[model samples]
Target: MTARNQGGCDGEHVCRIVDRAGEHFPGSRGKGLTARTQEVLDDLGVVDEVLHFGFRHLPHRRYLDGDQVAEADPHAQRTPTPDRPYDGGLLIPQWRIERILRTRLAEHGVRVELAAGLAEFSQSANGVHAVLDTGERVAARYMVGCDGGRSTVRKALGVRFEGETKEQAMLLGDVELSGLEPDAWYQWTVRGRGFLALCPFRHERSWQLQAVPFSDLGAEGSFPEPSLPYFRRIVDDLAGGNGIRLSKASWLSTYRVNVRMADRFRVGRVLLAGDAAHVHPPAGGLGMNTGIQDAYNLGWKLAMVCSGARQSLLDSYQEERLPVAAWTLGVSAEGLPRVAERFVNGGSTDIADGAPSDGQQLELGYPASSLSVGGDAESGPRAGDRAPDAPCVDSSGTLRRLFDAFRGPHFTLLGFGESCAGPLRDVGTAQRGLVKPVWVGAPGSGADLVDVEGHARTAYGVTGDTLVLVRPDGYLALRAPGASRTAVRDYLDRVGVSRSA
Candidate 1:
């Protein structure tokens, strides 16, 4: 549901989301939201609602040469951790997520103007000037292009989209059909023809179809048009027409494998995000997830800058995310071949079959960024690592998790011992609601947060009087070994986190 829309503004319709499509329709076949992505939704306060509409994982039932059903679980071996609550991905339709996000936005008086598109935009010292497809004008402080691949914003920035388009092409659509059981995802791969997969939508009554026809529609090697009639013929040809009827297409799209990324993510006041920043093979279900990550990382930084933080904070967006985009390109490049091989050898369930262990993305860290600072500590999470979670008790003997402390739009100053109390109070007072300091120790030892089962200490690898400063996005910005307030304060000052040392 990530669009080629304009985002980032407020009040008097100053910032608007301009979508080129006239209506809200599910557009892509990507529906996997990984564990790391769930963390982002948790911070935004919508993970429970999303979970209500999604399933743990769907089994892939493959049909080889029109017979013999083979069933496999893509996420069978994964398990949840004290630190990583979500193990794999949740399978829900794209439209459901879009609706949830839109509803959340509307609660804050944010309006999404449908049937409107970003015709063009220009950046000036004062701000940004934009013209919509409806011939309306908009003025804003900054602009972010959350648009998809083939984005108008990326093109306008003259950012070189460096990569190659694959020789293989595909037909993807959502439709109404009968004679197919919705119990498991159905896949078919004949001798030389490519594979076909039908995944039932968890929320909707329809199913998503992705396949390669290889039938002659015209020219030398051109693919067939994504029409209901053509899909019917192909399905019939492959299944021998076992009374499986196809009709009324709700959505249809042609997918050409494109692995590309922008040379740079920003230019002046205008910046690029999501598919506008990177596009990859649908393998690993990384296209939509990567775009969502882009938005999550940019959202807070943009908010801070708008509230008058230093401009350099926005520059870190490019520094930290560009490397991740490069990593995504590599994973997708290797994954497509595994999926392609499945058509011949029956190795995969869907396009997402080839993703490696790290696809959960829970371990993704920004160790090299300028924002990550301090310590030559031998063990524990280093600066820029994702903050781990552990179950614990509050001073009132109430059960809580480390995530409960880090949930909102504020920093968490976790002191491993009572000796760090002075720095904690000072930081809490200085940053006000921006920083919350929580002490971890035994009850009545003057520790507000008790490590009930020693899970917090073990998870953090804490063996001493240490202090870790977690960013609003849940990554550690500073991890000082000696509970030094000076260390914490100096690091915050450098990152433009308000409050001088």
Candidate 2:
């Protein structure tokens, strides 16, 4: 099926598409958290228009104390034009996504559109149809449900989303704080008034603040926040004697904690992806990143399946991403109670104390199921490792880098000196559908990078004419001290990327 990029009232519905279009890719290195996120998206080539069909009529607002927050253009806050590295939202800016998607997707040959409601969907042979919300029903052999926590498609299929909603309700508000430095994240915890965290806001000279709980009002208080005094009190206590002031209240709402995961991610022609399959608390900022990873894992697999590259390639998606998602849910579950405990006791965790591990981004290895080589052997930084990106030099005797070749979809083979070039090149091209080799350093450069007296060799271990084959996902598939055709073939067979395509 042709990819449709347009939908959502204005062009704003495509923010996710634009947010990741060129953000994540090989060779595109970035500094700071937000830029890193963009590079991740760019490397993955998630260049498509994202559709924002989440419950719209559900009371959305962007408030500014007395600043008149403007109309619901939908296209306003679509793309994340990140200005700094440490801008403090757990993930990308929590608001104005669709607007960015509109602009980003257009460049990738996709359009954004907004539709009112779901009119129909595709069902199965037991009286099922292959269609969706729009009246135009197109039948496809496969369907993946990415709909959200309350998934309509999952329910229709009789799949259960099991989990409990937390009894503790929070009065959440996003506000701007004045008289505070724009350079850092400020947080203050109050005894009975709830907690407040202040951080930078994108675009304008405003800051974003959140006041949790706001009040001790029971869940029966009907909707939290008509109780402005309670919220103000929390803000007041958090400010302490510092005389801090807050204004430009943005969104004020209530959220009940929830954690859930689908019993199964796939059933026949339909599959589950992102929140449609699992939902968890907003701790650690894993929610959105997890969903984006889900998209990444599935996108390439789907492309392969649709392109007829391999049939078994499709099943690996669930095998690879499901367990990772499950582990993420587990980690998130562990974090929720710890957060509450910290709030209740006024005790600081390692995070609150500014520990080194606080902001270290998570990088997960592809699961054993996703391993393409050395299945039973030792794990990590071995054959079948995501070839790390580092600086290096070319055969021209000039300093370049390793990531330059790792960017797009090309077979990457690495070797040390001129002696191994003929063998490496011969072995790489010996097979028509597999393997491509590239030499690093120059002829007679005194063996591999180990002898070069630089960071490049130390980074990639080019010591003594090592030969390494890297996979498309940046992992190393094989490493040999010398050129070995048998070793290369064995590594290829182990990873299912054999010469016998």
Candidate 3:
């Protein structure tokens, strides 16, 4: 392919595509964007290039139009969702994102060079240098360390990862089983000795199982790899050797739990994300999700900073994400021990509280920083509110997600129907660069039209007609039930946005 300027309606800077296309590129998974997020990227003009590779091809069909596309294909089944219950372990979205990334990154002009391991990394005031296993050195303006708990970059930076490793070990394996309860996750315990959890993956033929042995029960004081016999023994302990039978096994691995967080996410131009910065026991299946969110949060900020945002804007990344990671690590640390205790003390089978905790749920707000909009005066979870997606209507009389129009780098103002918030709509859109107003509800609904379901209403805590300004990272900036342009302007200026408009 040739270098080309793919201009947009806005102008030449909208997007550009210039790179090699086809087979030369290699694709690596385990961390990539999903189809839904990819569509968002396309809409934002963040990626404007395509290069397909061998054994990597688009599915040629959309999966989200209420269709079960994955059920029809063997390969597609590898990506599973909560909608489909499995007798085995569930295939979380993080894994699905990985599958898509393996294909999409190459399509988006990322040259994936694999099989070559990293040997060393060196950093200077100029930039960071990575020496690959093949003796190739790659240099970049900045290097992000997304490489799991044992980060090579973090080591190269001479930073020590602070945390304790657990002696309790878990044996995990994916197996094919039948005659088991279908469509739900299963957990059973042997009354203070061991506990077993079974989750279904994508295919009916496979499932992931985790078995935790009680103290000093194993030969080496660690849960070792389980053969067919050993697995059956644990199954019998949990299920009394009935109700489920297993035959085939896929992948088996052993993991030692650890809870740790790095001192600083940023060391000069090199930064850390995901497990590299914080590692926690996998109680809520959040290790991967948190890591992915870290990448997503950092991805756009890095892009904006590199493209020309205030340098202070870049510093806010650590300020914003570190708290979230800290909260996640704390919650996980609190949860796993409780879970272990419950299993040991007769397997109570009580569910962990799924309701969002103050620290667990909110889109951590940054105070005393360039990105913060609201002042530190507010109490409760107001300072750090996760931006809520609502059912809303567009100007053309079509229903749309509140998050849809609010995409890209801008503050989104959701004008809840016209009655109560009609005045807010006018005030919000009039603010220009600082605010982008979007009207929700039908054409003639009163300014305070509230059509959200119970779940959304409960999540957002919306009482009546309101104006909710969502920040770029999907956090509530300023919220008011009534319209007030003066209030909006004051908040924007506080956040460092110019108020010339």
Q: Candidates ranked by TM-score, best first?
A: 1, 2, 3
Candidate 1's displacement at residue 122, Å, is 1.9
lDDT of 2: 0.50
Range of the 10 consecutive residues with the lowest summed lDDT in candidate 3: 49-58
| lDDT of each residue in 121-188, candidate 3, tens digit only | 66677556666667866665467776678887677777778888876677777777887654545666
Candidate 3 lDDT for residue 236? 64
Assess the local accuracy of residue 161 in candidate 3 as a C-alpha lDDT between 0 and 100.
87
Which residue pairs come into collision in candidate 1?
3-147, 4-147
In candidate 1, which residue ranges exceed 4 Å CA deviation?
A: 1-15, 216-221, 241-243, 345-350, 444-446
User: Against the correct fold, how does model 2 do in TM-score?
Assistant: 0.70
User: Per-prediction TM-score, please?
Assistant: 0.92, 0.70, 0.69
Candidate whose lDDT is highest: 1
Indicate which candidate wins on TM-score.
Answer: 1
lDDT per residue for candidate 1 within 174-208, as digits (tens), equals: 88889987767788887676577788866667888
